[model samples]
Target: MLTNIFIIAITAEAMSGALAAGRRNMDLFGVALISFITALGGGTVRDMLLGNYPVTWTQHPLYIYLTIGAGLATILLARFIHRLNQIFLVLDSMGLIAFTIIGCNVALKLGYDTPVVIMSGMTTGIFGGILRDIMCNRTPQVLRHELYASVSLVVAVVYLTLMSLGVSHGVNTWGTFFFGLLLRLSAIRWKLSLPVFSYSPGRWGD
Candidate 1:
């Protein structure tokens, strides 16, 4: 079940990445590259950190083909996608929550400590989008946006707490998914955000 959702999440992310590439006036190759990164970069980073050889996408070549195909599909659908920003936001949030849970599970199985598990979840949730943004020459949204990474953190924390309380895997997964999705939707609807820190440039002697 989670694997199926993961596939859906990656497809959505691939399309989102394609949109970003198009906005940058990138070629077809660039679109495909960005789509691949946005779909799998986070999991790649997580696997590398955990020393898990053969990252997820490589082990499952279907993921690679699917993501690239999604990007190309996005290029064909670009004319209609701009109006579907809200839909994509929901899909992206789903991906964030799903990836975080999956990453946390991987770390837990490896006997990692709590902090590592949390960080694993977050890294898996956000790094793909961060990489895509970097490649597109833009600031990463998770670093400066409304409750993006926070949503991942919330999901991880909730899942961990549930696990420690001896919650069954099925309950924990569904519960955390709904909780995280609601939090993300609320953030978007209400424009919820952490306070930004901006600094004014000053003369050295001032």
Candidate 2:
């Protein structure tokens, strides 16, 4: 079940990345590059941070093939993609939540404590999007959009708490996945967001 979600999440992430590249009028290579990063960059970054060596995708090259195929498919389907914007958001939310779960599981396996586990999940959930935005020369949506990182944090916290309370691994994973997905979708539907704080100095107060 988790494996299925992982596959779906990466495919969705890759397609979304291709769409981002398409919006920029990028070429095929650029689309593929962004798609790859958006699908796997988060896990790569997390592994690097923990010095886990040889990253997940490096060992599992089929994941690369899958993401690249998804990216190319997005190009072929670009004409109809706009019609599915809401569907796109739903899939993206799934990917976000799944990525968070994967990150938390990795940190737990590495014997990290709660703080690091939470941070690991957030990093894995958002950093790929962050890297995608940087490469595309735009502000990362996770940094500014509704409840993005907050969703990851919430998922990780609740997941860890449940684990501490002796919830079965399968049950905890499934329960938290739905809970996080609901929170994210609600945030999108209601336009929930963290309050923006903009600060500027008026020429050092003149």
Candidate 3:
């Protein structure tokens, strides 16, 4: 079940990265590169932080192939895809939740504490998009607006709570996934965002 969800998450993220590359008028190589990074960057970072040697993609070469295939498919179906913005948004939200759950599980299995588990979830959910945005020279959505990382944090908390209460693994996983997805979709639908902080300079000698 986790494997299935992970595959979906990676594919969705890859497609999003491919679309970003396409929007920038990048070549196929650029599209593939961005897709690969966006799909695996978060997991890679998480593994590195945890010292889970070899990284995920290196351990599962098929993941790399899947991302590359997604990139190529996005390029081939660019026009049709562009017309389906809402669909992509839905997929992206699912991917975010899926990644968060996967990250939490990974940390839990590794005997990490709750705080680390929560941070791991957020890192897995958002860093891939961050890398993709940086590579594309666009402001990351997490930094600019939306309840992106917040949603992931919420998922981690819910998952942890459920586990502590002795909830079944299947229930915990799906419940967290659905709740997070709903929160993310609602945020998108209502343009929900965290309050922005702005810095202003005062008079030097005032």
Q: What is the clash count of model 2?
A: 0
Predicted model with the maximum TM-score = 1
In TM-score terms, candidate 3 sits at 0.93
**9, model 1: CA deviation in Å?**
0.7
Task: List the global CA lDDT of all models.
Answer: 0.93, 0.92, 0.89
Report the C-alpha lDDT of model 1 over 137-190, residue by residue, as the tens digit. 999988898899988998999999999999999999999999999999999999
Off by over 4 Å in 1: 203-206
The TM-scores of all predictions, comma-separated, are 0.96, 0.95, 0.93
Which regions of candidate 3 fall more than 4 Å away from where they truly are?
A: 200-206
How high is the lDDT of residue 64 in model 1? Answer: 94
**lDDT (Cα, 0-100) at 183 in candidate 3:** 95
Candidate 2 global lDDT: 0.92
Sort by lDDT, top down from the best? 1, 2, 3
